[model samples]
Target: MKYQEFFSITIEHSYFSGGPADLIVYPEEKTRKLLEKQGFLLKRTGTGIKVLLPMRDNNRVFPVLTADDLFAFHVLPTSGTVREFTDISEIEEDNMILFTNEGLDIGTIELIKSETVKEEVFQNFPALAKIEIKGNQITTDVIGTPPVYKAIFDSKSIKWKYYLLSKSGATDIAVETRGDQLQFNELEIGNNSLDPIITSLRLNFPDTKIAVFESSVAIPLSSKSIKDIKLIQRDSVTQTDSILMKHLPNPSIYDQGIQIIKIK
Candidate 1:
């Protein structure tokens, strides 16, 4: 019910191959509460209380603020811990989840990043709404609807969605009629992590038609499911419906980047 329940800040670095901290700890009141719910309990020390993992017969000693030293934000190996900071001090991260409202038992959560409430995102569609949560309360600064980076009208929307979602950050894009005045309409959210290259992507999906929009997302031709794909242009480039038979590392794009794959 608290803001801390839905969000935590942590920095992720893939370069830490050497010895890393078993935990990245920034013990806050809300964080402590969550940990308690996760089976951590306080033991009476000589002078005060200390957060420790519930003792197991195996003598597994879990660490915390008073337990041990820790790194920024690495998985706990056997398990993972949340990395909440007192301030936004980290500079970089990859595919980190800032906030999520899943399993909250609430229908909708209006998250206002600014100081004044303006709009609420409903099912990825921005709409006017009231800002009220169970225990989370904050201000917001919303000038208007999210700005659209690029648009694809009645016949061209996938390219913009396909392109913007491929990158990180909230793509401030709008899909609407031609207006140089820079007005925006409804918007949509994208995947949390950037899509991987088609080749590196595991074809664990059903044997059905899959649409892969042409962005920088690439794949290899190792899978027999993908014999050869054609490149079609939907972006506002030199051609609207240009087609070219190309293989991996060169396929421009197809209509919505449709790849007919019969995954084995």
Candidate 2:
């Protein structure tokens, strides 16, 4: 099974902005032919396999499908532009706002994650020349007179698990602007605390807010993000007033008590 990404866009279409129209998907020659022969209108763009939905709600999620699975596509008049998703990692803290296809910028949305952040050094960000990743840290350099950029991701299992447990207790996660990106490390669940890794961007920028989430009806659960596999716990850890589920090959390890199992 393969997972495909899809974005939900809502629009109150009008003559000024754009008229209502169906969405086009599956632009590939072979795929389009197959789908067309099967009585379906579809297309794919250079960026990705198009699977457009009618404008209604605003949200983002990667859709899952098998290679042979065909998505129902309704071909309609192509209207409006796309505010392009630059990358899955991070974007300019300010540009994270919800924007319209026709250059309409809404107010900033909450930060998706407390770990990743990026910013421009000067007027026009230069093209990337090289990128190097070491462990949980990433280093990138642009073509000519631009400063180096750095990003840090916590790979340690115990620390981040503990951090999530701590932050879930009706507290706003605070990730301050240390150098260029947001950094935080007090995520330890063991007797010997692990060291926190903080990376920096050489340029100077204003301090941005990266919080956990707004205090509301949101309920936190002991689940890991599909993008990150480091949060999977194979062993038991101390939990004062929290829930921890085992996500290992051998489930229900707690019933067997703590064992000295080796990992590769």
The best candidate in terms of TM-score: 1
lDDT of 1 by residue, 1-264 (tens): 111111222222221222222322233345456556646553332211233445456453333332122111111211221122111122223222222221233322322221222232323422211111212321112532211111000111122112212122222222222232222222221343345533233344323223343333223211122323333334455335443323322221233333332221
Evaluate all candidate structures by whole-model CA lDDT and list the values in order. Answer: 0.27, 0.24
TM-score of 1: 0.17
Task: Report the C-alpha displacement of residue 218, candidate 2, in angstroms.
Answer: 27
What range of 10 consecutive residues in model 2 has the weakest lDDT sum?
Answer: 197-206
Candidate 2 positional error at 48, Å? 8.1
lDDT of 2 at 214: 16
Q: Compared with the true structure, what per-residue lDDT tens digits does model 2 show for residues 56-97? A: 244322223343533212122243221111121244544321
State the local distance difference test value for candidate 2: 0.24
Name the candidate that leads on lDDT: 1
Q: For each candidate, give its TM-score against the true structure.
A: 0.17, 0.15
CA displacement after TM-score superposition, residue 213 of candidate 1 (Å)? 14
> Which runs of model 2 end up more than 4 angstroms from their true locations?
1-26, 43-264
